[model samples]
Target chain A: MNPEKVNLEQKLSRFDEHWSPKVVGELNGQHVKLVKLLGEFVWHHHDEEDELFLVVGGRFRMEYRDREEWIEPGEFVVVPRGVEHRPVAEEEAHVMLFEPASTVNTGSAGGGMTVADLDRI
Target chain B: MNPEKVNLEQKLSRFDEHWSPKVVGELNGQHVKLVKLLGEFVWHHHDEEDELFLVVGGRFRMEYRDREEWIEPGEFVVVPRGVEHRPVAEEEAHVMLFEPASTVNTGSAGGGMTVADLDRI
Candidate 1:
């Protein structure tokens, strides 16, 4: 394959759907995605692998059953497996997520919000 | 553990060594690191895994057996397993790298330039 560079702004321009993730890069067997979120995400959890949420721009908040935390730009959070949580962004926020390639954003609770396939950005 | 954010500038301030990677985050069995480089790196390759190099600042270059590529800020490159390549930076450059936590900077050809341990940033 030809060498490619994934610039943040360039990737953001390809997708306009909020909360929908665009695959930016893949390392080993994991996928790195960029998403723009402006509302609340459903409460869900992964059963087998941990999820990383890195705030690239704006502010985001994630609430777990036991606690809630705010993530500012340049910050990140690791949501452990099976820990129920929801992500909320008051304003538009840009995020970078790292997870296993098999992971689904909404887990087994598939719905309209679930992104069908990862498109290379 | 307390919730924390990893701002790129904040992480870079914690270390000053060029080419020595500092662990900025960990997910599953992999490590995310930030490295600053100038000059040339010893030619090496990982036997079991691929390596990712994301340029965060300045210009960088890499030479593979078949071709050489120039990487500018906001760009990245992936070196497939067992591919011999050398990374060179004309001026000081900052980069983000992702690999399995067990990966050594110099792999088994350890000597000088090998970082002792990954310190949290």
Candidate 2:
């Protein structure tokens, strides 16, 4: 089997759209996605799947019901299932999200930010 | 719920042992581990779980049965289940491994490098 190496920086350079996640790799039942986040995202929660957010570049603030956590480069946070949270980035931030393949971008709060069909970069 | 942020660099700084994986975070049924790799690892393959290797710093070469793939910083390679592979790093490399919690470090070709109990950093 030919194991292809996925360069995150190169894959990230292929896209400039914010909030739209592009699949970079897959393992087991999970999909590794790269997204450029800016401004604020909708407050939502995954009812059945946990989401892993890793900051590849820049910084983002993860706002929960109680407090806000700043995720800087080389930092990661795991939002467990059913936990309401929102991500806000003051500037363009490169992020890597690891979750189940079936996970939606908007979670329960589907809106314009919802990406039903994700692009692979 | 308090979402604690896991800093990869800070966690990696807590340990310097090579090949021994330290758990940094957990998502679903998988464990996100950080390991420092130097020199060559033993040839091995996981029978029931696929392994995701992301190079956090430096570079490493993945030697497969037929060819070798160089993984540099910000690059990742997923070794599918049951595929034979050996990771070789000429210099010290920082890497993050994502796989099932039960994944053995040495896979089927277990030897002294096999870590039955992983430490959480």
Candidate 3:
């Protein structure tokens, strides 16, 4: 009752940086984040967390060690813990990520795109 | 990588039961469920689990003791644990719910509408 409703489109419009996830909602010790993705991300794996990527706009490609899948809008793919993966977007893609509050964007493969400190919108 | 991609619309089409939630995906000890709602739901509260309701198609309403909010497509609302709430949908509304695997559709308010054993889609 206290928390307000969140609109995905309105939340997506507040940021533009690629791979930078902004926390939009939190529940059950998990943070629901919104990230605008473009190009290819660093290959990484969350040693302690499983990440759920739901495409809100455009398309997202989840590349695993064995295969890759294209996730269109309204579709989601879950990358389980300890599984190496990378996300690639041909164009600007709006993604909603669900994971623990401690999850990092780059995961174990920290790089320039690593967002250690995320801001809640 | 072991988990498959889930399409919201495709999953919603598999069931037509009202107030009954079907699990579509699971991650990090949580379950992603889809339920179609019509009319009003029982007032209930989850003592230990927070519930997130994300509207995928049509519209929904989250009614609390004091106020209520209309949730349209692309909108979501998080009802914290122990907060009494009820969902109302004048028309058929497709919703995606994210909560712990132990969550029951009726919460603490058990009745004929309570679905204890949910089927996975």
- Which order, best to worst by lDDT? 2, 3, 1
lDDT of 2 by residue, B46-67 (tens): 9999899999999999999999
User: Which residue pairs in candidate 3 have backbone atoms (N, alpha carbon, C) closer than 3 angstroms, thus clashing?
Assistant: none
- The lDDT of each candidate is 0.80, 0.93, 0.91
For model 3, what is the error of residue B77's alpha carbon versus the real structure, in angstroms, after optimal superposition?
A: 0.2
Q: What DockQ class does candidate 3 belong to? A: high
Over B1-121, each residue of candidate 1 has an lDDT whose tens digit, in order, gives: 4345567778888878888898988877878889998899988777877778877678788887678888886566777667777789999988888788888888756778887787777
Q: Evaluate residue A100 in candidate 1 and report its C-alpha lDDT on the 0 to 100 scale.
A: 81
Weakest 10 consecutive residues, lDDT, candidate 1 chain A? A1-10
Error of 1 at A109 (Å): 4.2
lDDT of 2 by residue, A1-121 (tens): 6789998888988988999999989999999999999999999999988999999999999999989989999999999999999999999999999999999999999999999999987
**Model 1 bad stretches (over 4 Å):** B1-3
Q: Which is the better candidate, 1 or 3, if ranked by lDDT?
A: 3
Instruction: Between candidates 1 and 2, name the one with more favorable DockQ.
Output: 2
Q: In candidate 3, how many Å is residue B26 off?
A: 0.6
